[model samples]
Target: MTPITTFFRNLEAKCCASCGQVISEQAESYATECYTCQDQASTDAYKHYYKKN
Candidate 1:
């Protein structure tokens, strides 16, 4: 690949909002967190919601 292409690709790369992990280019456009962080957040939310009931 040309240097210009590489530069543009890196320039457009996205990172996880929570952990700063580099997000995969193939990931969904609306995803803001990495899979690991997403899973942890889901688990925490589940526990918190259930504990209140």
Candidate 2:
């Protein structure tokens, strides 16, 4: 409602490290990436880890 409140809220906003997207407020405070990027990274890692020679 107030400008100061809005400013402080914006300060809490975070960006994803991999996709340059805004991280949701619901995400962990220490998260470095958005959920989408995190999910993609997890999928990639799973694929790589399970890949058969």
Candidate 3:
């Protein structure tokens, strides 16, 4: 089976907009939120799911 890790590797070098630390794209969206500064982005996935209904 293909490891999901490979797909996530590229996002590792992404620096957090709030914390300035490397955060994966996936993690940036879900686990985003600045680790050092403040909120990075919106955690809209949860709202989007219910909003579609």
Each model's total of backbone clashes: 0, 0, 0
Per-model TM-score, in order, reads: 0.68, 0.68, 0.30
**How many residue-pair clashes does candidate 1 contain?**
0
In model 1, which runs have C-alpha deviations exceeding 4 angstroms? 1-10
1 against 3, candidate with superior lDDT: 1
Error of 2 at 8 (Å): 3.6
Following a full C-alpha superposition, what root-mean-square deviation does model 3 have from the true structure?
A: 9.3
Rank candidates, TM-score, best first: 1, 2, 3
lDDT, residue 50, candidate 2: 90
- Tell me how far the alpha carbon of residue 18 in candidate 1 is from the true structure, in angstroms, after superposition: 0.5
Task: For each candidate in the order shown, give its overall lDDT on alpha carbons.
Answer: 0.84, 0.78, 0.56
On TM-score, the stronger of 2 and 3 is 2
Candidate 1, 1-53: lDDT as tens digits: 57965666666568999999998865337889989999999999999999999
Q: In model 2, what lDDT does residue 17 have? A: 88
